[model samples]
Target: MHYRLICFDLDGTLVETAPEILDAVNDTLEQFDLPGVEQSQVERWIGHGTHELLVQALAYASGVEVQAVRAMPRLFAIGQAFDDHYARRCGTRGRLYPSVRETLYELREHGVRLAVVTNKESRYTQRVLSQHGLNTCFDRVVSGDTLPAKKPDPRGIEDCMRAFAVPPGRTLFVGDSSIDAATARRAGVAVWLLPYGYNMGQPIEACAPDRTIPSLASITDTASSSSSS
Candidate 1:
């Protein structure tokens, strides 16, 4: 492996979680007597964590603005309800992307340190990983609330590097959105984006990552590692 450490973004990059996320969002909206949001809307609302996504859904369903939804007197209760709904729906509709396990195993076999830095909160992150039998595949897991700031802040990536004593030059961040690309850039590390993951309905190439490989398997030596970090 050309890189010593590789960090992943959980939602779209590893797990095809939009379906479950949409289900949870709709479940919460229905419980609140508000209209449900579509999966397309939810996909665009992702990458910022569930709280923001919930707020967006509420705003849309209730015919209110995002700020108005946030200012609702029952906002706290609404968040709680969404959390409950999402917790139950964690892995119900999500699955690991193609070759995800194989690529991860190959990377580990080559002695590459793996980590997950996601905007997902800790509880949900744990459940999702565990549900997919991926809990032990990573060396570190950084959720949205794990540190002082989340992605695009560089703290999580920096924290991982510091813990592993790996330099930025030998680190790679793989994600499915511009947020991930920005996070890697802020941390001064190379980034690779996937074409199949959520990107707010935008093109992956628009994120300008170091590489836009077709899938996780594309990075393995046997699969076509034509480029290196």
Candidate 2:
């Protein structure tokens, strides 16, 4: 195979975490006597890091315009509260996406290095992965809190490349968001996107990944065909 490493996005790509995330966000909102967000809105709010999500959610819930810099500190506190709640209740409603385990196993069998690059907090990400028995499947895991900068900055991808000792041309980044596409582009690696994952309510196809798959398992066939060509 031409690809030596495959990096995956955590939240929407490998796991369906919407239910738990929405629940946690709602719980935190309730504590503040704020109106809860709609499920669809929460879905769209994801993909960015936790702080960004919280800021947007708070702005939406309080009817405060997002441009208010004065409210940022309070929103950051609410975001931290949401993160705490999520950590306590993480994975309670989340599960591996269909075919995720099978695909990871197959890729591991083929000796392809695998890593997770996500905007989730490192400790929480570790807890969720361990609880779901996915910790062993990945050779390395990079969380949003793992570095000073998150996706779209190329730092996380650069870290992944360093961990795997793989060059950009030989690495494949699989994700479900424009953030991932941006990260791949910045890192100079090939990118594949999954249609079923979150893309901040935008059509993932518009991100123009090198390839798009309906599911993670489909990458096997796509990779095989790409190698042959």
Candidate 3:
């Protein structure tokens, strides 16, 4: 299918941010005198957004349910600590997925507009993009805080479509989770999933993306002809 606009998810699709995020969550838990979780556990909590990750982390650390953690008087302060730690360490440990840079350049060369639609807040999104020298690759970036609601709502995808003047059929959302698939479905766009991203402990195939690709390099060939339809 030919597509003019290509939207990507941040955490798992484009970059592996689990390490830094996990470390920050652990750091916050330690600050509250709670036990830290395993990295594998934190990986399962990724792709939802920092707030959700922190909530889950707090719940896991304190051996309480998420609701209990939410009701705690120190939840706000703990959340702030997580936020601060993450802000300082966001891009320090993560690296772009293989072939991402090359594929993005190839897509841009083919005149396909690129944008990021992430559940991450804009504050850290910009930092990650700039840190990895990816700030120039995208034509637009829509963060979790940019809209009233996040993925599965389609608002961000719709906003990207409007910003790029692309129709649903001519747009594709590339991500690593069901949230991205749902977002594309609700926005009437095509979705392609990556096999190696965080899908909340489930296989990416369970997300039912239109296609599952091995790597970003594979998209270069498809994206070249994608504008012909």
All candidates: CA RMSD in angstroms?
1.6, 1.7, 1.6
| Candidate 1 accuracy as TM-score | 0.96
The TM-score of predicted model 3 comes to: 0.95
Every candidate's lDDT: 0.91, 0.87, 0.87
Go through the candidates in order and give the clash count of each.
Answer: 0, 0, 1
Estimate, for each residue in 1-229, the C-alpha lDDT of model 2 and write its tens digit.
Answer: 6788999999889988888888888899998999998878877988877667777777888888877733565766776788789987787998888889999999998899999999987877888799789999999899999899888888888998998799999999999999999999999999999887789899998999999888987888889889989
Ranking by lDDT: 1, 3, 2
Q: Quote each prediction's TM-score.
A: 0.96, 0.93, 0.95
State residue 133's C-alpha deviation in candidate 2, in Å.
1.3
Tens-digit lDDT string for candidate 3 (168-215):
988999999988999999999989999888888898888888889898
lDDT of 1: 0.91
Q: Least lDDT summed over 10 consecutive residues: which range in candidate 3?
A: 220-229
Query: Any runs in candidate 2 off by more than 4 Å, and if so which?
Result: 67-77
Preferred candidate (TM-score higher): 2 or 3: 3
Can you write out model 1's per-residue Cα lDDT over 1-229, one digit (the tens) per residue? Answer: 6688899999999999999999999998899898888899989998999898888899899998899988999999988998899889988999999999999998999898999999998998999999999999999999999998998899999999999999998899999999999999999999999999889999999999888888898877622353432
